[model samples]
Structures are given as C-alpha cells and as structure tokens.
Target: MSDLTKLNSPELSQFSHILSHAVKVPGLIFLSGQTPTDSSGKVVEGGIKEHTAQCINNLGKVLDAAGSSWEKVVKVNVYLDDMKNFSLMNEVYEKLLPSPKPARTCIQAAYLPNGVDPVIVLNHPGQIGAGYAPVLDCHTAHIACKFAELLEKIDRRTNKSIEANPKTIKSGDSCIVKVVPSKPMCVESYNDYPPLGRFAVRDMRQTVAVGIIKSVEKTDKSSGKVTKSAEKAAKKK
Candidate 1:
C-alpha cells in the first residue's frame, strides 16, 4: 500500500491475518513482538528460556523477509510474566543478539497468552530439563553427574525431593536444588510439555514453587538504638 512495506513469512505465518509481522518505510522498520507459537499457532514446548529462543527465531524469519538482520535491529522490548526469569532470559538473549546489543526494555506482565504462569514447577521426568532454569539450562554432564549426586542424597534421606537452601557454598558442587516433593495434581490430563503445560494446569497436587534466585544480602547484626519519641525529652533534660 503506497510506499509502506508489509512483511510476512511462512515460518511466522501464525498471526499473518491478524497482524503484519513487520513494516518497513523509506528509512525505518517496525517489528511486532513475536511469541513462542510455532507455524501451526500452538505454543512451543520448553520453558521461558526456550520460548524466548523461539521468539527470537521467529523474529529472524521476519527480519529476513524484511531484508534486515539482528545487526540492524535498533531496539527490542521483552515482556515477561515473571521478572525472576530475567537471568535465564538473558542467557539465551546474549547468545543470539549481535555485539553492542540492541536498546532493550523488559517488563513483567501479570499474564502471557500461553498461560506461562511462573508460580508452578512443571518438570516431569518425561519433560526433564524442561521448565525451571536451574534444570533447563543444565547440560548432560550436569544432569548425569551433578543431578545424580543430589538425587543420591535425597534417596539416602528417604525423601522424594531435597531442599538445599541456605546451603554452605564450599564448592561449585554445592548449590541450591529444587524439586516437587509430591505428585503433580494435574498431570495425566495435561501433556503439552515443560513449563507451559505445567503452568496450564487448572489445579495442582500441592503448593507450587520453582524459579531462579533473584538476590541475597547480609543483614546487620547490630541492634537498633532507641530514640526519644519527641525532642521535648532532650529539652526537658
């Protein structure tokens, strides 16, 4: 239409009818935010990290169609349902984008369309290394060795899951580990895989807790000094 250029691609056709993936003019281009949906419009498997990867991939397709590339991108806006995922998302983002990085802004949303609620831990053995970052980001060696070590300790303690919070960090081997202590409440009915399916469950077997560590700080041991309620006490003295 006129001098405006609209772009689309088979790889990113899921929302073609609803919206243009990108639009280019004489000197500038505007790109729509790509979600984790595949060609068929279904949300992709894997957790936020994987989803973010897919989104970037989709953007690549759109960029290619527009005759542009990551190197040309001037800005990026990332929307997350949970801000805690900032680190994990960074991991994948750093791997994909070009040097110097694009001007970017990330904001947490109360909800994402695919129902990726961060409050639940959605890793079943079938979807191992699926959702939560500590597990999802681990490699085969980490799982086979580090995870096995943690599992052995759990087995010895007669526990289904182990808690390593406040663990003394004597070595890299010693770090926090998380697990679902009980069976997931909405398991058999949901099989989408990883974090999305897990987060999609209408009800749960128990309370849910899964995610990355945000911050840690040392507290002051000194007690607070009492102060007079009013300056009148000093004046009277």
Candidate 2:
C-alpha cells in the first residue's frame, strides 16, 4: 500500500534493510540485488546463462525471507545487461515458473547486482495475480519494469512514446516515471542515448530504471539456451 520497493540482499545485508516484521503486506524484495555466486560472498562466474541461474537461486533466498516464493510471484521484471543475452536469458527464465504464468516484462540493463537495486514484493501470490501489479511501492522496480515495457512498444513503432513526468525525476534527467496500462506517449529522439552501464547503478536509494535505445540483432554464437524454472511455472496449476 506504499511506494516502497526493497531489493533484498543478505550479502550486502547492511545496505538498506527492514525489521523482522510479519508479512502483513505485499511488497517487492531486492532493495539491492546482484549476480549469484554464494551465500558466503562470491558471485558465480559464467555467461548470461550461468549468472542468471545463480541469480535466480540467490533471489530464492531473498524471496523466502520475505515470505514469498517464485511460485507466488505474479510478475517477473528482468534486467539483462546485454541485448545479446536476451534470448539466452529468456530461455533460462521461461523454465523457472510453476504455472498459470504471471505477467512478465523484460528489459536490457547495463548491469544488475552491482550495488543491488532490484526489489521484490513480499505479498503472497493470492494477494495479487496475473494482469495486476503488486499492491506496494514497486515504483522503483515497477518503473524500470514499465520503462522496459514502454520501450518495447515504441521499438515496435507502435507510435506510442514515453511521456516524461516532472515529479518522477529523482535527479538529473531522471523523472518520477510511470507507465500507463495503455496510453499514448510522444516519442522523442536523443543524440546521447544513455549507456546500459548507467542504467543499473550500484547503490541507489530510489527505484531507478535507466532507459536504453538499441536494435535487436541476430548472432550465431552458441548460447546453449537453458531454463530451470519454466516447467515449474507451467505446472503450477
């Protein structure tokens, strides 16, 4: 019921935190998140596929503490650092769900887990279902989620561009951004497009979703797509 998104991270346990309060509310976790490596403080090494799998496992610990599991998850917002990793990343993700698929949104970020800024809602899945957003201040997480969604639409040349809001700006050109379920937004072109690296900041206080402009390209390099959660998502019924 508030605009607060916390990316849970036990490794950076001292970054931003909360009390051992009951789950009287639903919220996003990840006050800060990074690549998966170890509970003892070692980020696993590998390509997008390896890092992603470990990241999801690491997220499990965080979600569990928040009293929510990926099965209870209603939506998954992804931040891929490289566009080339998109397909491989999706292949990894599609396999993780448990069924009745939750609405999913994906975006490419320059980085994630650096300072840990991905948040998760702690509410039970029964509290929120597909097609609806979490009843929490996922503004930070949600904003990035929406920004990615909006960009997708625009990239499709659907004609709707992102409308800038003044209050949404936490600083600099960043605005207090929000995405409409379906609305008309004017698209504007810029010369200095923000780099993916700048998007996923390491230690940010606000729910910051950095926007990137790019064209999807095809490559023949073997990605070896893998998914450990997709079947779980499909069998949850």
Winning candidate number (TM-score): 1
* Model 2 residue 215 lDDT score: 24
RMSD of each: 21.1, 17.9
State the displacement of the C-alpha of residue 215, model 2, in Å, after optimal TM-score superposition.
33
Note the residue pairs that clash in candidate 1: 185-205
lDDT of 1 by residue, 1-237 (tens): 699988887675444433798889998999988888787556787898999899999999999988888998888999997889999999999998879899999988654544522223332322222123231211111111111112111211122224333222121122223232111122210113322222211112421222221111222335342211100000000
Residue 40 C-alpha lDDT in model 1: 57
Question: Candidate 2, TM-score vs. the true structure?
Answer: 0.39
Q: What TM-score would each prediction reach against the true structure? A: 0.48, 0.39
lDDT per residue as tens, model 2, 1-237: 565544444543222322321132444443234455565444456777887787777666667667677777766677776688788887877786567666877786543544222222112223212232211121132221122221111111222324422222212222122222222222211112111111221123532223322222222336642211000000000
Residue ranges of candidate 2 with Cα displaced over 4 Å: 1-14, 17-34, 111-237
For model 2, what is the error of residue 171's alpha carbon versus the real structure, in angstroms, after optimal superposition?
9.1
Q: Which model scores highest in lDDT?
A: 1
Q: Which stretches of candidate 1 lie over 4 Å from their true place?
A: 116-237
